[model samples]
Target: MISIQRSQHSPIGLQLGPSSATLVQLAGSRQNRVVHAIAQEQFELDEKQSIEERDANIAAQIRQILSDHHFKGRHVISCLGSQELFIQNVRLPQLPVDEIAKVVAWEAEERLPYPLAEAELRHLPAGQVRQESNTKQEVILLACHTGILKRHLDLLEQAGLTAVAIDVEPSATLRCFHNSSNDVQTNATNCYLNFGDAATTVIFADQQNVLFLKYIMQGSNHLDHAVAENLDLPLKEAIRLRKIVTNSPTLDASDELHRSVIDSIRSILETISTEVENCLRYYKVTFRGKKLDQLIVTGNESSPWLIEFLSDRLSTECKMGNPFESLKCWPTSTSILERPGRWTTAMGLAMKEKSNS
Candidate 1:
């Protein structure tokens, strides 16, 4: 199981995705808090490096970055994408936190695809579920394997950075919204779609109720490849062009290469629509009373046009997710906080500290 003696407060948050790594540091005080965000320099593993070598290098680079920034000895919370872990909404007889382990083990036999011993297990009590016909009450259980976690922690330890909390990226993303949105819409059905490097995570929750979750294997890399193929350029050059186009309207959005990129985006939209609809359908069947109210998009791979396209296709009102947008910050930190949507996971990891307080 993922070991935790007691949760330690971490001011620095590291969100490592397949494509890029984001670092967020808490700056200033309680009265005038701000975030020092860095997204430009990311650790990219060499394809030629072995798994052990790559993990070591990732840790080393992270440490070097911290040293260079003069951010030594700061507690750091590392995060993992949903694709790397397994999560199931298991229904079990309601019991105290300490007693849930045996139940988790019993459920793991049926729920987990691998051997029970091969994975580490963890669970959170998601309230009680009382059945009308029977007197027995059940609670939601969340389980995660240890093997998946060690891979991430091993890398961090190798890097010379102290890992405080390891978080699920989707949970972290949703936590960002939960912290930002007031109780006015507390019970409303909300969905957060995080477009990470290797995959996309869709989280649908209603206040304390988590209804749907899915990770799709689609991502922005397809667009990169499409641009490269059509432009007859290397992948790196294509990525450069893609960013240039996004930042400036100088290039023709209708050019042959750009059209290919657009097509790739459309494909992503199709999958998102299908997956979201499936979730909505399941939610409707299970939770007949609640209705979905909003959809938010985040992650470095997300694009405004993608949201617009999906909104039109799904006929659901969509908005950019900027968890830090409404939060108070210092004047000098305004520029860094401009793109708040991209920092959802990091902000959420940092918010864990706030929750403990």
Candidate 2:
């Protein structure tokens, strides 16, 4: 139900997340590319402001960001978090391409949480499934509440911008990895883990298409909160200490504070590992012969310790994902690389133009 209009100019990419909004503008062809600007603004909720007023304020902030960056055009492709959308994989009998949509709508009526009349549904044909006597097709179904979509559209309209298409975070994250410089093994299955402030999304895929997706409510913020509570430190200080411990080679056993920090971080890592293991187990059961080849972690929460911990626990090769690896940018774009993981969704949204072309 998302409409995408291809334009001559580069389309702006926006990711409105629970904690912040990230916007990226890219121009020129891929070979002569220039990453015009990448900006992120954290939201400060005011209890006194009504929902409308708060949205208007955020729109005002977005306008200022675009104006200061000298970005052109008001059209953008945005991404919604998995928490805001309903995604499911459905299997249906083989049918003509034209009939697929109609069948999917009927199926969605029963499966979607929202009323079919009040939801905008979209379907992507994943692939075909072969049975002993017949063939069926697998489809990825995405449904969003009409109110949620309208709210986003209204916010962008108030910001003097138009949203051309809205994408899910998991798909956008997959786009980042697919377009990265890393060599993807065609025959091997891979899992992409997007760790966000509110949730973590695990996407099972290969070089071509997504095989499965699972959302875990636990995220990097949970780890930060745990560290803060365990260490009896302020949130900011706990965040700093987490980074220090994660990046350090080893904790000082003689220091009680160091030992405590280590223990807290390990506990959170163990939780994350367990969740990932469960997903992997399901994947294995569903796709008997297939094996997960590697794991790619991305998002603002990804760190050295997280990767190392998951690698050891999952017994799989794990690495951090870099969204900027394939793009050429101006000198000012260096700042975008600092938190490359945070920009994956936005960067992937920006790549829609090229991908479609």
Candidate achieving the largest TM-score: 2
TM-scores, all candidates, are 0.82, 0.84
Task: Give the C-alpha lDDT of model 2.
Answer: 0.77
- Go through the candidates in order and give each one's C-alpha lDDT: 0.65, 0.77
Best by lDDT: 2
Q: For residues 203-254, write the lDDT of model 1, one tens digit per residue.
A: 7777535566667776656667767786688888888777655443233566
* Model 1, C-alpha of 243: deviation from truth (Å): 2.7
Tens digits of per-residue lDDT for model 2, 87-196: 88888898899999999999999999879999988887766655566666878888899999898899989999988888778767777666455665656788998887
